[model samples]
Target chain A: MKKQYWTEYESKVADDHYYYERSCIRQSFFTGSEEVFINIVRDLLGKDIADDMNLHTCSGIGYYSGVVPLDTTMTVVARLFALMTEAGYKNFVPSCITSFGLVNEVVDMWHHFPEKLEQIRGYLKEANGKEFDVPENIAHPCDIIYKYRKELKEKMKYSLTNVHTGKPLKVVEHIGCHYAKIFPRQVKGGAEFPQVLVGMIQEWGGEVVDYPERRHCCGFGFSQYMVLANRGYSAANSKKKLESMQPFKPDFILANCPGCTMFMDRWQYTIAETEGITYGENGMGIPVLTYEELAAILLGYNPWDVGLQTHQVQVEPLLDKMGIKYDPKDKYVGKSGAFLGEPEKPTHLKVKAYE
Target chain B: MAELLDMISADIRYIDGLKACMNCGVCTAICPAAEFYNYDPRDVCNTLMSKDEVAIAELLKTDKIWHCGQCLSCKTRCPRGNVPGLLISLLREVSIRMGYFTESEEGRRQYAIKKTLGEHIVDSGYCVHVMHVKPHLHPEQGPVWEWYFKNSEEVADRQGGNYNKEGSGALRKISEESLKDLRKIFEVTGGKDFFEQIDRQSKKKASELKKNITDNVDDNEYFYHVYREKNETQE
Candidate 1:
């Protein structure tokens, strides 16, 4: 009966023909994870994923933070759909889960209130002289990865297993709240236990730790972090998740949302600095990777090129455990082999530096 | 006060989120904010269910509206389908428009958001541009970020980001034509007016607090106060 009930919430993902919507914050936070994802799709899988430079943000951050009004958010969303319409694509894929939820929420609102849709249509026409057809399909990047996890596993150079112990690496997968909690039917699995990241982790030869606070948010509440005064709430919430997962002894953390990935990574250092506690083994912090980064590592992309170094919690410890070989010297080098200078190390989180 | 209630009643979030509440604590029990902060989604619903204008006005004027993380987790658990998170969104907007956002520490911090995320949307077509994640403002971003900040162009190019360049890819420069349309959308939809309201109310509040306010939005003394000032009350 439980299995039967969960199956009712499964979402349908499009096979191909994706109009890729780049996330504004993902680029700022995760740096090159989007590029890695595009490469995995276009280069590895031979999928046709299109991107338009004219495309802008969905204004989700501002909208959720309470500065941008709903009317403006709706108009901005309409313009994105217009870009998709102009590009001759029906499938929409947003890199950020927040954008995914924002678009879905706006479209759902439009469906329930056609008057709001009509008002937005007028605003779009008057403002930009453009119109948009609602997209036929909307999928997050993780949904795409989950759909083709088998094909990716076939092309893998490494697995999530720890090469030293020969055991499946234990991982804690944090799904962004907006990814499915708001609308369960839109995700691969239901809201309670999303299979979007779990499907990928299992396919890549990893063990998923079922933590008590698994459903709790990573607390990248837009205004919570944007305003320094409220950041304690963000940190405290993340700490709760980390503390809950601590007893599970997970090897690393992975998240689909860029904001969650960032907070989970950085807040480890913040926790270490302020509270003098670390979640991972030894004195090192737990490595936090995006779904794209995890895929890139297994697919044999250069660690630096995939932007693993951008994370505050060092990925080196995890890389070493996985026995993925790379010249530590190349970590800070430019694309042309020119060496970029190393950054100062922190007092708490352990980061490997080579002269 | 009645006008404020009318404003909230007209919002789509309010219309969709608040159906009917039976004073159940299901939402509060599951809420992450409730665990950390002195927030209860049940109390918020109970207040709205009463429909008392004075109480609603007081709710809007306090930090209670801003206590929500906007995770919408409350929506998933509500037996009556009352989404307290969405109601909070409505309450927050009404708070800002009514100039009641300046009444508390949390509400006043919307000024920081206005200068950063709010302004970034109009100026860069991004809520968070790559160039704006300065290491100084975001110390949590850590040491590697400092290196990334200095060698931004080289690193961005290597990572396949367009990094303010024309054409397609990650962090590509959004075209001027597209930005003009985006700006016009903000204008047509009253987002520009909303930004002005945040600015106007925030400036008035700054004067009330006697902080050194200036025309420079980013570097002003009042901006610094709201952006960095630690309110220990949260802990």
Candidate 2:
């Protein structure tokens, strides 16, 4: 079974000269993730990642939530490809896992139904007065990071080992379900155990914690989170994963997808607030970080500069564990050195160094 | 009534997602939504396979189809390569098109998404823009998020975000030309029509329920009804 799925799951990642597509959720919520990703890929690793200011959202959220039709999604994606084509790049790299999956789904549709692709082309020409060729390569940023894991490790100022215990941090790798489950072949490792994140963690000197519900969705179900009443379903699914990973006592939850990273971090606060349950030691919720933010910390970037302060579950605990130093006073300090007020302290979730 | 199976069959997602279901229940076993809710991906697939239009129509109107999180986890585990999640997507599209979605509590919430995410796409070229993330609406974002949004510009600037600026970077203002092109794409691809249908149907439902809905979809009265109203019994 493994061999069959593995054989079916081959994909080629472009080494350089890529068109970087931004993620709506990551930009809106985790504002620093995309910056950290671009810095790591472009500045640190010395890769050419060309971005277009004209690129728009893939509408994956709206499409999956059933408000935007699939045809609309296809046309929107076609416009994105058109922009990439205009920029003279064929390697498409979306910052969001949802966009990656949706783009792959649209391209797969085009492959199976040429008429639909033609319709999209007509729509593109009529609407935007442009044309597009499907990208030659579609790789997620994590895939690129995985491709350069060894080089990144070579340049790392810190490792995933605990400063206190002198042990490898037990990291829970949460693969966004859409990242691989939608099309196993598109992912680095097959759907069951996606190695994109695990590979990064292992190479960066962290032990991967194998939990039972590791394969479960972080429950960002586009509709589930969008609708206020349906949020219970979203919170419940995250609670399930946290509960499963609680026994292992992971140092942090590492996710590649923006939605997964956000939900896994925020839902910990929700669970702590409602149920008074904390997943980490000393009544603290387990911190969640995107692979980029994790990589940024290892590459010696300041914690707050990577937008770690925006995270619901405070990343200070994880930073402390990994021996990454950050000024506690700088958590709310802005670029001009002004103190931008702090959040109202949570009643249940522990913050400020386990006290 | 439109043939439910035909509507589903027309979608490429359905053609690819549904191959055959021997009722193995692997999809159900691995389904997180099933574990949490009354949803069963196996049953959803079986219903479609049965080709019973009435049963299928009934499934469309119920809250079951709306329960899927769109994670596509079922696609990986099915021995016959069935993708129950994609089946849910097609079912949802059919339900909305046929006006069956408004019949259920969960389905009515699509109105909120239509007003927010759907409209955000046509208007701002983003489904969830930073400016639209009201702290009051998203309390789960927690207090820190409240702080960030309170000082969003400064915080964004510190993090190297353009923050609604004219140039490329995180949260840069999507260009008007790009937005015009996006709106055109939506207009040409039936997205505009889809949003209008959602508004029309939701307003009708609001009137049927005597909620005094106004012309503006973003008004608090009707918006809150669809966005926040919770039905414990059905859901």
Candidate 3:
């Protein structure tokens, strides 16, 4: 039998299971409001969670789009740490859609072909001395989050309604590329825009604004080539999505990933300037947020605690537009809502350091 | 002045994509070219807004922008959805419009490659996945994957890939036609002859580089030259 099938059986038998994997964007989540959300999940649900950064790169979508080498990606994922998630009896869960998708690809590939898997195993053993046994039910944070938004909402202390004086947020979602591409059926609780971000936003009192390019991947693929000064294939793709999304005039453009937020927010000003166009009122740019960043606001966490200001593009204009006035200058108060406080360095550091 | 604004607006209209930007900064943080260089997608946005063409020209001069490994990571990870990889191509338009496409050996090489890609797609209705190789006469890097995939056209025909040819081929053709239709959009050779030149001579020029490396250097050295050395030249 394939390794994934057995893992599926094991996953069904066990109730409380979770795993963490590699990411460059994980830095955003570990910092502020996202950290709070993770803790809430653990305390409120009593599920197991593992976070690690020393893991191999997820091959990223760069490979899929025909840029990075295939074998290098395999070596990075298969040889380095896809196997690490198999331990301690918890299902591996990646917060990044790319990482999660890579997990599924690797597990499915190595399970069926013993010889090819051995070659991959040998690559791992030779390159990093790591052998992966494939985890039981490797999945995404969205997979679980989408399934459990109702439970999450019930346990919340604050309300997303009345977030602004009365205006519901004109929020649109930035679904990660891998999650939408690889696990579309799972997150597609039947909507043009997936239900997870919409459900969380609308229930939390933000109005879901469906744009034409709602299911688009922000120009992160060409992000690495950004030195090309807006003259690369990726930039062209970025413009494609931007033009498609231009009609909606979303107050807040929310994303599930750090990379997405940075690309949409940080690059807009350049797109505005070089192109000599006005992006927002008074030439203001669109405000991009992570799901958890919005979660913190809706949950009544302070703005800074959610790292709203840390964003390259300002969120204040959109806040004002939505009739929500978060003092962007609010300093972190070290409040521990459910999971963690502003640690001396952050306790999660110890986990990766220990590994 | 209207013409100037039109040209200027058109040049930076790629920024309309920035308006499309969700401001996720995935392009900034994940950008390899941005990481190593003194570049930031955010800074690029700010600079673009400043509209100081002097600063813009200075920024464009850096080959750092060209160091893009052509990895579509930025496009894939983009959340509010934009394609920075395509932006890099637009940036390349700056050089093309400057009339430097055939200047340096490297520049000529790039022109040839693009010309080949443009030609082959028009001819076969699929992307060029392989390069033509001729042993002893052609250079080592000369053939590319073309020898293996040379038969893919037939395989495409056999496997129903040719059916979608209308979708992609016509799309590229329409794009090329619309670009040409833009009375002002210049430098991209829109004529069919341009692509044919690329297709005819790609193997010849490829052999020139292939022999330059294969006869003189080891495989590892050649690999390093391609994957590393080229990127290190920050010009």
Task: Write the residue-wise lDDT of candidate 2 on A1-355 in tens digits.
Answer: 3555564565579999999999999998888889998888889889899878998899999989989888989999998999999999999999999999999989988998999999889999999899999999999998999999999999999999998989999999998887888888766568976788888999999999999998888888899889787899899899888999999989898998999988988888888898898888888888899888899899999888889999888787788778788999998988678998888989998886457
Number of backbone collisions per candidate, in order? 0, 0, 85
Residue B94 error for model 1, in Å?
Answer: 1.1
Q: Which stretches of candidate 2 lie over 4 Å from their true place?
A: A1-11, B2-5, B215-218
Model 3, span A1-355: residue lDDT tens? 5543212221122245665553434432224433544655577667776543233235344333222223334545563344454455446666566566566555544564456566666655654445665665665555565456677777655554444455665676777665544334434442234556766777666677766666655655532332232233344445556676667766667777655665666456446545655344445556777776665565556565555544544566555444454652243222222222221221111101123
lDDT of 1 by residue, B53-169 (tens): 999889888877887888988988888978999888888888888999999888888888888888888888889976888777788777878888888777877888888888987
* Candidate 3 Cα misplacement greater than 4 A, ranges: A1-15, A28-34, A53-56, A59-68, A79-86, A111-114, A155-165, A189-193, A222-232, A318-355, B1-235
Comparison by lDDT, 2 against 3, better one: 2
Ranking, lDDT, top scorer first: 2, 1, 3
Chain B TM-score per candidate, please: 0.95, 0.96, 0.47
TM-score of chain A for the candidates in order shown: 0.97, 0.97, 0.75
TM-score of each: 0.97, 0.97, 0.52
Q: Find the 10 residues in a row with the least total lDDT in model 3 chain A.
A: A345-354
Off by over 4 Å in 1: A1-4, A353-355, B231-235
lDDT of 1 by residue, A1-355 (tens): 3455556677777888999999987888777899998888898889999977888889999989999998999999999999899999999998998999999999999998999999999999999999899999999989888989999999999999999999999999999999988998767667897898999999899999998999899988788889766788899889999999999999999999999998988888888888788888777788999999999988888898888877888888799888888777888876566888888888877675331
lDDT of 2 by residue, B1-235 (tens): 5566667788888888899789999999988889888999999888888888889999989999998888888888899988998888888888888888889988989988887788888788888877888878888888888888888888888888998889899899999999989988888888888888888888889888888666565565777887888877874
Q: List DockQ, one per candidate, in order.
A: 0.80, 0.83, 0.02
